[model samples]
Target: MAKKLWVERNEDGSWDAYSDDGAHIKFGHGKGLFNPGDLMKVALAGCAALSSQFPIENALGEGKGARITVDGDYDEATDGYTAFREQVVVDAQSAGIHGDDAEKLKDRVERHIEKSCTVKHTYEVATPVTMKVKVITK
Candidate 1:
């Protein structure tokens, strides 16, 4: 299923991004909005969590999820991020997974995330993006 997404500039000078499924996010250079870089970080973190969700829940019982945090340093000269660090935190001890079992689970989850996260893979491959501009006349 191909999903459509778009962004619109608001009257207040901020931008609103929307998906066909009714998802909306306030973005751009604003006080409480997410910038482009923030969105990229969030996408990577979300992809990691989702990729590992099934394995994590299976090992730690249903509803047990992992928290993923993604951070990076942006270089002004290049206008891009230098590196991103993603940390996935799962409390195996609380779920009765310990010692060797915990280590095994950790390794399994990492492998799953590494194999399944498309967003991370895209970033790793540095996917090419093309932009087009249209002019409207009255």
Candidate 2:
């Protein structure tokens, strides 16, 4: 199924983004709202976490999960992000998987995320974005 997503500006100048599934997020250049860059980082982190969920749960149990953090470095000269670092932390040792087992689990999770995370794959490929503008006149 094709997904539809859009953002509408509010009277207060902030924007509300909505998806076809009813997911909503408030974002703009305002306090207590996520900026565009922050959303991108969040998307990457969420995708990675989801992509590795099955491997992590299979190794550590059903309720076990990983914490994924994505940080992007903004370059003022280019007015864009220069790099993004993602960290996925899973406490396999606490689940009794130790030493070589933990390392193997980590490697497996990384490989799974690298292969399955759509957002991460997009970032690596540098997808091109095209915009179309509509002008309305009274």
Candidate 3:
């Protein structure tokens, strides 16, 4: 299925981006909304977080004290992300995951970080994007 989005330019110069699922967002400088580039950061960060979730849960199970977070640091000059800092804060005493298990956890998480996330792969490698333009007049 192909998903579509529609964007409208407001009278005040800010723009509203609408999704196919009745979702709307405003974006522009000083518009207090996320610009398109910022949204890319969001996608990368969110993908990283989601990609890491499974490994953490699989290692420790779905219980208390298994918190996973991924924050992407964006490089403004390069117009891309410089780093994605991941924090997997688990309470060792509560979760009963310790010793060699802890050692193995890092490996599992790292394996998934770069390999699993689709968006991260797209950003890392050169994926050609081509566009064609046509003008329609009434």
Candidate 4:
């Protein structure tokens, strides 16, 4: 079973997520090139790439490796929403993978990402959320 991860940020500006077994990731809000939200999209893309690996390999038996990349396009002017597009390129010399296989793999990856990715799933649903802030003078 996968370990449950718990994430926290300290007052000193450090961040980390710990699992039951102590495995975790360390990073801060401003420490990376992009924020945690951006990393969420990257993780979705990474999941797509990794999930498609098996299909690609099976389609290209004893074939050369191929590179698959997923990109997300956002429209901030329209309420900060984004669409994800995946690009997959296969080597011509590869033994099993072909144009058709690549197309099928792309579709499979798309469906998987839409349904399985945490960020994507969250974005697809509408949740009732509200925020309240109180200011105190000392």
Candidate 5:
């Protein structure tokens, strides 16, 4: 389903990609672009954040503030990533999603993000990919 995502690197040494659904993302080592490792975080964390949107809203109602953070310690030599640590910080006191209700809502929100976020699920079950390198000699 994600094969539609395409990548391009410019002469300026910046990377850019297009998502299957038409999102344009830029990557680089400097400025506002996302570096390679940060991109991984963005993919997983962004998916989680987006996936949690509905649940957060449902629990706290519309227009409430909820922050989701996801981090993975990646080892490049092995291309292996450690378990992701996630934190969902909700402004319970201000938003009214406090006490027992907030705790249950937070638990449900985490579960929903883990279950429904595609990127997170994919990483949970790693897969082997077959690749072919093509050298174009035009």
Candidate 6:
């Protein structure tokens, strides 16, 4: 299994994520004000991007690469959100392969990533959540 990564929040509302291999990355409020949920999207995009290259190369041969861009539309109320939409463009090609083939390859790659990515998997499972809030009068 691949090694795990960890992230910790400091007292000042900043965070540092570290890989098991000893790499550290800073994230949070001033350095980009995003939560763990937002970072999951980035992770999904990155996983999809890397996974896409394999099949394109298999069908089109080596020296071909693909660029994948992912987006999503979410409504906070329903949570029946479209998690990701990927736009993939192939930069190199082998004989007899055209844009249509590239698109199909993109679809295949997308499906593979959806099935394999950890963040995407998290979205597929509905976790039980409870919320409580307190109000104070000044």
Consecutive 10-residue window with the lowest summed lDDT within model 5:
88-97
Residue pairs in collision within model 3: none
- For candidate 4, what is the TM-score? 0.55
lDDT tens digits by residue: candidate 6, 55-133: 7677777766566666678878986565666566665444576678757766787776766666667666886779787
- After TM-score superposition, the amount by which residue 90's alpha carbon in candidate 6 deviates from its true location, in angstroms, is 3.1
lDDT (Cα atoms) of all candidates against the true structure: 0.91, 0.91, 0.73, 0.62, 0.78, 0.70
Can you give the lDDT of residue 41 in candidate 1? Answer: 99
TM-score of each: 0.93, 0.92, 0.65, 0.55, 0.83, 0.58
Local accuracy of candidate 1 as per-residue lDDT tens digits, 1-138? 889999999999899899999999888886998899999999999998888998899999898889889999999999999889999999887887888998988898999998999999988876788989999999
Which stretches in model 2 have alpha-carbon errors above 4 Å? none
The pairs that clash in candidate 6 are: none
TM-score between model 6 and native: 0.58
Best by TM-score: 1
lDDT of 1 at 12: 92
| Candidate 4 vs 5: which has more TM-score | 5
Clashing pairs in 4: 60-96, 60-97
- Which of candidates 3 and 4 is the stronger one according to TM-score? 3
Residue-pair clashes, model 3 = 0
The regions of model 1 sitting more than 4 angstroms off are none
Error (Å) of candidate 1 at residue 74 is 0.9
Q: Ranking by TM-score, best first? A: 1, 2, 5, 3, 6, 4
Query: Mind giving the per-residue lDDT tens digits that candidate 5 earns over 57-128?
Result: 776678764676777888778887777776767776766667789879878888878778898788788777
Error of 5 at 67 (Å): 1.3
Question: For each candidate, C-alpha RMSD in Å?
Answer: 1.3, 1.4, 4.0, 5.3, 2.2, 6.2
